[model samples]
Target chain A: MIAPALHLDGSARYDGTPVFSDLSLRVPAGEWTCLLGPSGVGKSTILRLFAGADTGADFDGSFGADDGAPLDGRMALMAQDDLLLPWLDLRANVAIGARLRGEAPDLARAEATLARVGLAGMETRRPAELSGGQRQRVALARTLMEDRPIVLLDEPFSALDARTRSQMQDLTAETLAARTVLLVTHDPAEAARLGHHILIMGPNSVTPVAPPAGPIPRPVDAADVLGAQADLLRQLRGLPE
Target chain B: MSGWRAGILSALLGVAVWQAVVWATGLPRFILPGPGLVATTIWKSRALIAEHALITMTEVIAGLILGTVLGALSAVGLAASKWARTLVRPMLVFSQAIPVFALAPILTLWFGYGLGSKVVMALIIIYFPVTSSFFDALMRPNRDWIGLARVMGASPARIMWHIRIPAALPGLASGVRLAAVYAPIGAIIGEWVGASKGLGYLMLLANGRAKTDLMFAALIVLAVFTILIHAVVSRIATRLLERY
Candidate 1:
């Protein structure tokens, strides 16, 4: 599917407290847009808003596909929690979207998706039997099986150990390559490594942060990547440099 | 130890304790029959006890099936609709507050002195526990899974069928296990209130005739039956839990 760019211009309030106001952002079509900010800045809320999920907040805004189409049924989401149903094995979990929608799941396709996520031949393993990283891979496989044009990830790799987190970043960057991806993260290095267009969201405003010049799934030790990571860190910390 | 071996050992211990109590109390044989006397009576009246045991078993099983189905449906309905929750949950709680055991005589009067009254009694006794536990679990599904299903564009019915129901199976299993133990109580009470045949009715008959040994045998059969049902239900519940 050709990914459509998305636009959100509005404000939201949670329990009568303002989450964000006058927030305007663009997720350029078919590219990675990383949203970075401190906790409670509503970065994940924006992702929720775009994914058509309940944000537990009253939102008054215009958010839609750049193609002027409704975003429903064209989106998939991955959260820090893998959200695999414990009762179902890996393949069934990967095909859960179709099953939940009352469609006959394509088991062959689900197996292939698992293989794509490097979990080949583990189709019958329950979520409990797998390591945390393996479970996240199953989640990734589920997300990929949906094949939606827009994918929203809320700190999907933050729970992993340092090494596993970096590995996951690389896999996700490669797998979700052509989709309209919006990643919400608090990790500066993550944004620097994967974001094609980065936006640092403060309490009330959204500002675009320039990424280091390179192809995404960027080398971890690259000089510009480290520089960009440090700069994003400083910017987020309100530390002028 | 194997389960059967442990169970046999426990039964032996219980019998020994019962025999000791009988010897210590020196109660009249009619008042407290010893294990040996009860065993002899059981063997001699095996056919008679079996006939009555069959009736009570039928009542308990029928009640269990009916209660489990009705309770499961009520729980799912409550979970699925806010209207059902608002309108029915209070009534369910109110029903529980009315002690169900006290309703046995009335149930017998309405359903008559046969199997129907016994079954209805069993159903009423177990309905609330099954509904309450299953409904509570249904209401509190894993939030993240529900969110994920919603984002996948699942309809409410589809979500309930594929997610909520399966997630709540363990809860439902627990309810059924509880119902197994409680079902015999309902059936026996209904039989006690008014019945032509059943283990409960036989015990009452034997007591009136001062055939205490026969009454003791009947009581032992009832106890053994209840324990057997509980063990079977527990095994099934554990398997269901493991599978789901």
Candidate 2:
């Protein structure tokens, strides 16, 4: 399915204190949109809103797909924690969406997806047996199995080592190609490398930040990517560019 | 060392110490029979002791099964509904404030001196630990996993079954371990209050007749039985932890 563009314009408050008011942003369909900001700037709250998760705050305004339909049942999320059930094997974890919905899990499809994520012949291993990167690969496989048009990633690779992070970035980008992905992250380098359209969010407003002039999963040490990364870091630090 | 070897070595050491105490104290045969005399008494009265032990064992096993099932069900019920948690949780806590052992006489009075009262006694003793531990675990599932499951469009019942209950199995196993140790106490107390059979009744009968050797033998049997139950339950609990 072709991804639908997401448009959200809303205000949020917690315990009668406003988090952000008149915040508006659009995630273009079939591309990556990275929302980067300092911690506690409601970046994850925005993703939660799109994913239809409980935000633990009062949200006022309209947010929906530009196709004029609700985004429910059309989105999958990958959080900082892989969220794999420890008791389940890799195949079972990947196929949890079907089992959880009381449908017969397609075990063959789960095995195929595991192989797609490069976890072939390891489908029976538990999460505890896998390394951080391998576990995240299983998480990626689970997300792919959801088969949704929209994917929300909330710092999904933030816990990995630098080398593993880059490798996973490449894997996720390739596997989720052409899906509408809204990635919320604090790392400016990640935004510079992966975001097709970038938005820098502060306490009250969202500003468009132009990424490097290239496709996503951009080389880390490329001159333009480094320039964009430095510019993003300076912008985040509130310095004159 | 292997568990069995360690256990046997401990038992031998315990018997040696008991013999040393008997020799040092010079107590009368009726007052403190030596380990040798107790062992002989156990052999001589094995048939009689076995009869009473079978009764107590039956009571304990029945109570363990019933208590575990009831406690697990209550935990799930409490986890699934806010009303059950609000209305029943406080009642559960209040019930624990009343010492379960003190209720044995009342239970015997109500259910009579038959197996009914003994089973009820054991059930009451174990019900709280199992319910509370499992309920606490069910309420505290991994937030990220639950969030993911919710976004997957899983029904509430499916989430409870596939996620919450499985996540809480270790907690339930812990409760079962505690129940294994406590169940025997409840059954024995019930038998003490009033019962035609059971190891507790045998102990009291021997004591009344001044057959202290027989009394010591029965007490030892009861202790051994309780330890065996705990070992088995512990193994089961460890398997639950490892499997999950």
Q: Judged by DockQ, which candidate is best?
A: 1
Cα lDDT tens digits for candidate 1, A1-241: 9899999999999999999999999999999999999988999889888877778999998999999988889999999999999999999999999998889999999999999989999999999999999999999999999999999999999999999999999999999999999999999999999999999999898889889998889999999999999999999999321
Task: List pairs with backbone clashes in candidate 1.
Answer: none
Point out where model 1 deviates above 4 Å.
A239-241, B2-10
Tens-digit per-residue lDDT, B101-219, candidate 1: 78988998899999999999999989988999999999889877887888899998999999999999988999999999999999999999999899999999999999999999999
Q: What DockQ, between 0 and 1, does each candidate earn? A: 0.79, 0.78
> Can you give the lDDT of residue B55 in candidate 1?
100
Badly placed stretches (over 4 Å) of model 2 are A239-241, B2-9
Q: i-RMS, every candidate?
A: 1.1, 1.1
lDDT of 2 by residue, A28-120 (tens): 999999999999888999998887778988999989899997787899999889999999999999999999999999999999999998999
Q: Write the per-residue lDDT of candidate 2 for residues B1-244, one digit (tens) a residue.
A: 5988999999999999999999999999899999999999999999999999999999999999999999999999999999998998999999999998789989999999999999999999999999999999999998777889989998889999999999989889989999999999999999999999999999999999999999999999999999999899899789768876
Clashes of each: 0, 0
lDDT value, candidate 2, whole model: 0.93
